[model samples]
Target: MFSIFSLIFGLLSVVIGILATIFWIWMLIDCLKNEPSVGNDKIIWALVIVFLSYLGAILYYLVRRPERIKQTGQ
Candidate 1:
């Protein structure tokens, strides 16, 4: 009953939804386990992921990891 485009969109939605869910879960685990200095930043990224869905989650993983940031002083 579904057209090809419909099927494609359905698949895309499922994949995106799964990816977002997994990313949020991983972010939660990471926050709980680590004492990263940028805790607030990480939490904000996690909220952005949850609220904005797939693209936001992907962006959080790609762009906002605390370990990737440079610290200026000890």
Candidate 2:
């Protein structure tokens, strides 16, 4: 009985950890590839995301990226 419970929780933890890792990697890549037209804040936030981990990624996308920077007129 205990073995079955452990297996289920362990599997769930692994899956969640993997998903978080993937999202972290994706955010790092997004930061690097963001255009100069997007401005310096983008790079700053990207560095923040890479250095700070998951919270940085969430903050970058949720608050900074869409709301802070304007699209280039050109």
Candidate 3:
């Protein structure tokens, strides 16, 4: 029998996992669509996102993404 707290935590974990998967997919697609400009390397960034998963995606968003945006002026 599962306790209420345990059930809640389990549900939370599942939700978090789903959200993470979605974010990873979104990042992967974005990396694929955008060209490598300046500091960004498209293939390397895609691999990083694939291997590092959530952490890679976050890093790309925080670091490489802004650089690409700046380069494009959009």
Please, what is the whole-model Cα lDDT of each candidate in the order they appear?
A: 0.63, 0.75, 0.86
Q: Model 1, 1-74: lDDT tens per residue?
A: 56988999999999988876887777655544442555486567656766776667567557655444344221
Tell me, by lDDT, which candidate is best: 3
Candidate 2 — which pairs collide? none
Write model 2 residue lDDT over 50-74, tens digit each, in one string: 8889999887777755654465421
> Candidate 1 local accuracy as lDDT?
0.63
Q: Rank the candidates by TM-score, best first.
A: 3, 2, 1
Candidates in order, TM-scores: namely: 0.51, 0.76, 0.85
TM-score for candidate 1, please give it. Answer: 0.51
> Per-residue lDDT for 1-74 in model 3, tens only?
56988999999999999999999999888888884644548888999999999999998888878888898753
- Candidate 1 clash pair list: none
Clashing pairs in model 3? none
Q: If both were scored by TM-score, which would come out higher, candidate 1 or candidate 2?
A: 2
Residue 66 error for model 3, in Å? 1.1
